[model samples]
Target: MSAPPSPSSPRPRPRRPGRAHGPGHLIGAYGLLALTALLVLIFSLALPRTFPTLDTVDSILSNQSIPAVLALAAMVPIVTGAFDLSIGYGLGLTHVTVLQLVVHDGWPWPLACLAVIVGGAVVGVLNGVIVVFGRIDSFIATLGTGSMMYAVTGWITDGGRIVPGPQGLPAAFTDLYDSTFLGLPVPAFYVLALAVVLWTVLERLPLGRYLYVVGSNPRAADLVGIPTRRYTVYAFTTSGLIVGFAGVLLAAQQQIGNPSVGLDYLLPAFVGALLGSTAIKPGRPNAIGTVVAVAVLAVGLTGIGQLGADFWTVPLFYGGTLLLAVGLAGYAARRRMRTGAFAARGSPTVPPRSPSSSTQDGGTAGTTP
Candidate 1:
């Protein structure tokens, strides 16, 4: 039999380099960021008078903040391999609820805000129950629940707007959206703060690891003794709470309740969330990535608007970008899987020895063959 590998023998090196440094890795790593920069540069050159101004910066930040928040919210459920389509409808219902309480019921803004936020949590819990215990697919389940939310929103407003009294919404409430700190909109700060919080939770906390494991492979997570269902529920609940907060910001920003506004956000939110998976972490849904994705969209959209594009341009751009994002995300996922498979196949293996060979090897030097 051949001798065992000698202590001084060199190990067989892998045929391919590290996956993280493989060809095309650079593209996957910084493609979106580079595109964002390119867009900014182009816009600055195209509209030197308008695109590079502080006003444009503030506009992008202020307008994109809600969608950014909603995108982050959508990402939470995705971490646990689930979806929450109801976010849009929930936002509508939540803002309307807050308005109804403060305007019609004469409730204090703080109390009304608290009630709406709590109600959002309840809606999240219901979604969790439906998805976990009821065994309904998250997409279909959330769709149904979202429809119900829309129905409820319509009933609340009787298909009419909820405008605040002549005195206008409480200053504190409006200030939540309108106020600027350090030369930037408050909502932009909200986005940053929320991104930091989410990043900390997902990158530095055990719960985040559990959710990721559950998302990557629920069966494997279960086999490893992880309470996958519980974490999945937690993900949905967290997503609901974030959506609720975004709704409050929406209410504060608009100062009126319009049930239709929520649905308009759904597409952009999903675009940001899914597109984000292809950036920052590359192949995983992450908060910072989502924020970056939102920023990219905001820049692109704002730049295009300044170019005097037709009314249909916005939808066209978003639709095309969404498709591209999905395609790129799928490509990243497939590439990761290929890299893993190649690594697995290249791993060293030991050949099994027969019983006779084992016995012979262990025998004395004078032993018979």
Candidate 2:
């Protein structure tokens, strides 16, 4: 078959840098490495007595789960170029709903948890429908939904906390957050497992391509036969489901459901999501990056707490980091586009064909039709 199709003219192999895909990805990965080192150094010096200890590490891992979960919830919709402001509010309502069901309504704990999770998913689908059908911006849609959820929470508990009675709730349910496995906190394991599963879904599946396409150019994706609206709905639904699970964890962890505590989680969750777009996969909302971003914030906040910094400082730090991360993400995206375009221009192109009129002069076309 034509001398085995010419061994010297084999298909071009994709260039790889070590274990990573390319120079761009390697740069992103290295940036995360540098950031992790910087965080460790800063925390080590700031909380010299406690920051480096295993117990401190365990504490950070333990306390960070809820925020990390919420951050991931926010990040999901972000992959489709949308925002879910309802997550924080949803958490508030979900916890209260679960607690009320258990304590006030005398429902089983597992059923209460399930009902709340389903409610979150329903809310998420509603958000998606409002955005998709009503043509409302995702930010505005989620904002309105969040406000409604907040009002519902206030109505449910009359703006008071819901604490489980000793006989009403099972101790095993509380242990979902408090227990440890193999010397590590259970929440940490759950976070790791969830992150891994989400990473696979986002990075190694066609669903991810659809999300990227929808986010980057929804009209174009639609034109290319991708069901952008369906994918958008899926993103919001997944986000809502995750947020519901996070609320369950919150209730379990704190052993009480208070509407007041949830709104405080919003800023840090958004900060983690935005900060994630700057590392590990710069300009993309990646699972590993989100977790790492949450870890960085946890470590920093823990160190500050240990150093007796006031509570207000945490919000200030989160807001500042978010602004910085947005700037970095913008810069990285633009730079990547420019470099890609330049590289494309430098590559070879096939020659254009001349008219067949030359064939009359004993000239034949060499190019395939």
Candidate 3:
């Protein structure tokens, strides 16, 4: 038989690159965005007079801003591999606190807003402590804390609304949520600004990288000397602060403290956060993706409503979309892990010892004898 090829000889080229750049990759990256655009096109064609108007755009922007903010809040914790279930409850409590201070105690709107924001930070710190120091599971701890917050909200509001005095909320206060800037609602601008800031922090900053590392593998992060617990707490605290700001905006928009409204946002916030993972940068929570996901939901819901869909249809759509988003997120995450594993396995193997080299060594020894 012919001698085996030398180990140093060139081998056949790999049929595929080490990395895949196929349709599946593109689909994972831009599928949601493509769907969003397609939905807009369909809705515009179906309801040319209504769906494509500035009014619809403004309504979607204005109405979805709070959920967008809350979704971002939820996203911060998720980046560190934790969840903050208390966001909705904390939102209700914080806004109600704002209203109680302003309408009931005659505190100025600005000062009341300041107090609520600080209180939100405090609640966030509390959550971080409970989760990090107390060694409680984030989901369960936040859920319990959230329930307590709802109870506090009920106690403060006494199951009643807190309406502003006859003078009405300061025009400036309401304008925060009501006014337009560059033809877009101020809240829309707020959403954009927040997303930009978060994107910068999470994508450009070292802290963001640390958070991602911790989320990806806490044990690996710890092995690398990263203070995972401290960062985790920081993530939770940041989430709280953002949620608190959303509460302020909610107060401005509603102009009344409705203790029941916060929970309405929780599911939608989660849906946006989870769906966000499958876009922008697939398989991880990202700020821009969260904003885009929220926009998709707003567009879809608006389109359905314009089609004369019943009120129940709205919840059904949200519920179904939420389920789809969760499944996709989980699938994407597992897919990423599998891809990494395969890449590791397919890395260049060590060359086998050549038979020609062994035969040459044996001949040289025999000749010497």
**Most TM-score-accurate candidate:** 1
lDDT of each prediction vs. the true structure?
Answer: 0.89, 0.83, 0.89
Clashing pairs in 1: none
Judged by whole-model lDDT over C-alpha atoms, candidate 2 comes out at 0.83
Cα deviation of 89, candidate 3, in Å? 0.6
lDDT of 3 by residue, 116-145 (tens): 888888899999999999999999999999
Count of clashes in candidate 1: 0
Compute the lDDT for candidate 3: 0.89
Cα displacement (angstroms), candidate 2, residue 255, comes to 1.6
> Which segments of candidate 1 are over 4 A away from where they belong?
1-19, 347-369
Q: How many residue pairs collide in each prediction?
A: 0, 0, 0
- Residue lDDT tens for model 1, 1-369: 675544575646554522555447778877788889999999999999999999999999999999999999999999888999999999999998889988899999998898888888889989989999999999999999999999999999999999987899889989999999999999999999999999999989999999999998999999999998899889988888998899999999989999888999998999999999998778889998899899899999999899999989988988999999999888887877777677668755344444655555683333333
Clashing pairs in 2: none
Model 1 Cα displacement at 70 (Å)? 0.3
Give the TM-score comparing model 2 with the true structure, all chains together. Answer: 0.88
TM-score for all models, in order of appearance: 0.89, 0.88, 0.88
Residue 327, candidate 2: how far off, in angstroms?
A: 1.1
